[model samples]
Target: MSAFDEFAAVHETHIGVVFLVGERAYKLKKPVNLEFVDFSTPQRRLAACRREVELNRRLSPDVYLGVSEVSDVDGGPADYLVVMRRMPEDRRLSTLVKEGEDVSEVVDRLARMIAAFHSTAARGEEISAEGGRDAIRQRWCDSFDQVRQVGVLDGDLTAEIERLTLDFLAGREPMFRRRIAAGRVLDGHGDLLTDDVFCLDDGPRVLDCLEFDDRLRWLDGLDDIAFLAMDLERLGATESARRLLDRYAEFAADPAPASLRHHYIAYRAFVRAKVACLRATQGDAASRRTAREYADLALRHLRAGRPRLIMVGGLPGTGKSTVAGLVADELGAVLLSTDRLRKELAGRSPRESAAAEYQRGIYAPEHTERTYGELLRRASELLAEGETVVLDASWIRADDRTEAERTAARAHSEVVALRCVAPAEVAAQRMRERHGDVSDADPRIAAAMSRDVDSWPSASDIDTSGTPARSLAQALRVLVD
Candidate 1:
């Protein structure tokens, strides 16, 4: 019998028959044709099998044995297959995530592993500006076309999605080009979905990189990160997704790459939703039902609008910052404080600046301008990505409130201007007892507070003269309800 029949005699699947020969397992790719990928010729299949083995060795050195020719008949080579050290099937991330395993640790481990992998991977020196843009654009177009072919999407929903996609693309293309010009694109494992990750006892391993096409593998690091993040979110691991991103940014040690994070995330979400919708129409009955569920989830998240932006506006010592933190924690939002921004900009602690009388620089017109600008920028960006943002600032100026309102309006998001007010005596007493507070505004500043400050927005207002926890409970009711 031929070697193919011999392998088939051992295994069940005729296409890509997997068998154990000695200590290693051989995976042979059948000469099959797929819509996106093709292995039509024996030589082509052999080359792909060899590429998989070679590329996988970079990450899973112990698992990828090598590639070898497997002749159909004795002494006559007809095809080839990849040989690998068989791993415990349960070690796959998909299986672990399904079992409600400790995915946080697994994802965190993946972040570090991917970081190391990207740092060492080769980057294309000849990546053209237009070439990168076209590649991204083409991916989106092809994905949309696939969805169109499925024919399950309604006309109105498809049109709305198309509009949103075009809007984001138009605005983000310039930024993407700038990032590409700065060499943010590098050789990476293009397909980093959960199924491709293996959680071993030692750590996590990423395999099955895009070895055939360098163009697909060569991309902005954010794209790879987004793929993983999107997978985590889809698997109902939002917290794990957040932790993975946090760990990645911490280990990467550079915030420059973070600017592109939101854009990549949105793109990833869009593509994933599209694919899910397409599969709903094309898959088998059971799979199509599951795909419909995924599509509904995606649509809900897409239409949920940006995360709520809460601006805590009040005079000094009204417990604005404390209450803001509580609300942020409860809402799973980012807490942006003017006090922290001030300290970061001045290179001095709030107390030190207060003692030196040089702290006025933190609230100076120019510095305050910078702080508010950064806060609004971050808030809008996060909100657009469906993340809540809590802005803790005095918001003592009418112009500041107006600017924030305009930002929310432009982003099609909601803003809750929370006004924390307290009696003058109460404010002073709390500020005087505050020892480690980060705000430069002193208790004495409470006495100097005038009544001519900007008017609070007509939105919700909370009186913070009572216990902070109580005040936060009230705010939470308004936010969550």
Candidate 2:
């Protein structure tokens, strides 16, 4: 008997038929109708099924057995199924989260795995600016349509949401356009949720990528990160979201895109809520209730405004990034650093941009003006959208710190200046030992630093020369208070 003939068959409401072979499992796409996806034809479904197998191999090579054609005696294709090495049914991340299991090890491992995957995935052919804008607009339209079909939402509430969606998209159009122009879109796993992740003795195995269309899988990396973060929040694991993000940043060769985390997180939440509402409209009573709960959870996070803006100012190697990252993690805010921004603006890595001429370009009076201006602009936008922004920079100039304060005031938020102070000799020593850092400041730059550097902001000051955890704890308390 063939493997399919001997195995027990199962059915999945959303996808298709599944069969459990002795040591392997097979999933076959079913002919179905839904608003966002369709697998109605054998040829179309088989192609997508094959793509799924290939895409999933990027992250879970051990589990994706391969794709095989079901044949009727003569070895010609009859139907198709994706074969996978079987995993324990209870090993899903969603199950672990629900059971209140210790998942820190698993979560951290998966974060590093995803970071590696993003680094290797092929970049899509550059999209036209107009095309990018139209795609985003269509996403909003689909969201509205999905919400309306549920028929459970109040008319006034629906209209209010629709208005907010439009206004938010309109406000962020420029930044969206910039990302598209910069070629930030790459092939990514489309359906990234806890259910699709399985934990193994070695590490996490991610499976079931959206493979029907390249367009769905190809998107900005920020969008991909946001999906996982939003899902974590919906599952009531806010702290896990922070840890995952921090791990991603630490492992990635390139830093996380500056100040874009808040916007992407909100956008992902909106998408998740809309999809859940759409499913609730067509699902059974039990499933409908579950979907409503997910939608409601996402909405709650979206309405929670950004955390307050806090800047860590000092000379090079003064522990600014370390303290800022810790505070941002504790407060569940995005950490935006000048070091990352300077390199991104120059379109090169820190090492490449560190040439003498480039160094002058980076710190020139005009360049400094532009850099700080962009940082404040991004910080204000994220805060207004309901996210806390942590600005990390060597605010060696009184004028630059003043501009940041002004920006916070205009956003109807206060700025908490975290001044990191250390002995000049100690700062120089630390800078000398640094290597492969994205920050432009080096040991030679520190030698020129004067004790007459700018006056400290009339805010909190922490001496990072001692234990950093203690300093960070104090800063976090101020943020929470």
Candidate 3:
């Protein structure tokens, strides 16, 4: 009764209740202990409130005021509250996004602000461990088990998502170590939803970081930022989400692989799906639909993050390297050339010529097999690590092509085969004019190899007789198709 009636509205969450009054908000931790959070005692709740104020001030200094306590008539402490200066509800980013407002500039500024915050965030061994593969896998397992216990989502969909997530994490130990060494892991905003961001005229104020658990707050900066990105995509602001990530990458100088970004975003989506499922268990019918949507979004991101193995093959002087380069640039793929790999295996520089007859020298059948074997071996490792690979080689032999396909299958990846071809005169002239090139093949070698080449029925033929632009366009079309 003590100023309880003064609150215009009261919002209750699973772990806390917020009282919204004139120009102020008060948060009271609920007396509950869940599997993830524990605020069952007054002392613990007060400690949490103080921690929230101390941490949130790092971002929204002017918003979090302090902690206050209410007293009973008998002069005993009744309850504690986290007092905050209420932000403008109408200026919330989620509201603006739902109203169809253009928030490009807002997102840009937000990304920069987040990057700066992360630049000065706390980092050390403890924080870095949360970004490692084992920690990530454990958190994923926790979410999966929680969602399964709720039994709100279809078991099969949940199982598939879990499989994809675990498989992706299995081979990322090295990448995770690289991230830790590069100082990409830190204590970041754990719950960066659009609903908690206020876009004021001065700047954007982010609120409601998960202060209850240090483990939740300590994570890779990319995973922290992906929380908001995932929410923005959920709100149908796909372009704005992309803009935010691009700006963050530019501002933070983060060179994270695209697959890792997608994976983290997917993980965040699944976490939200778990929460939605919990809400559905509490009898929120609408949340059931939202849970499915989030789960499906997670699945979609998982599929997008899967690695690809693209084989660009053709006889020498068919412009295969050119096409492969273009494709790699377009797809952000790692390009590996048999021409370079072969020379490397033979202890020769790429430009060092090893001219020999067909099936002789470095081009010998035995040597060629070794080169292709090494190529596929390297590609397999890369694919396991969630990288798209473009192999620039003459995959004219059926055995090597089959081996590449098997490698991709082992990695749970996709294989794309492209065969480049040019007119006889064009190819001959290209081989004749070749200089400082890694390939040792001449027009004579090419003609002999052409006669001996096996039929390639599965590869998409890309004619390189036209302009390079035309050839690239054709190859891209084939790739997308």
The 0-to-1 C-alpha lDDT of every candidate, in the order given, reads 0.69, 0.70, 0.91
Per-candidate clashes, comma-separated: 0, 6, 0
Q: Which ranges of candidate 3 are over 4 A from the true structure? A: 1-7, 342-356, 360-381, 402-412, 421-440, 454-481
Clash number for model 1?
0
lDDT of 3 by residue, 280-398 (tens): 98889999999999999999898778678999999998999999999899889999999999999999999999998788888889999999999999998788667899999999899
lDDT of 2 by residue, 1-481 (tens): 2423444546576668777767688898887756657888888778778778888888887788788888978978788889999766678888888888878888799788887888777775542332264676787677778677777555565565555445445444555666655655678887788888888788888887877666777777666766787677667777887687778777764343333554456567666656656656666455455545554544444334334678887778888888888888877677888777776776777565453433376766677678888898889887654456889988878888888878776654557888887887878888888777777677666555544377774867778887879878877766556
lDDT score, candidate 1: 0.69
- Top of the candidates by TM-score: 3
TM-scores for every predicted model: 0.70, 0.62, 0.88
| Worst 10 contiguous positions by lDDT, candidate 1 | 1-10
lDDT of 1 by residue, 93-194 (tens): 877877888887788788888777767776665644423656677776776677677766565665565555544454344456665666667777778888
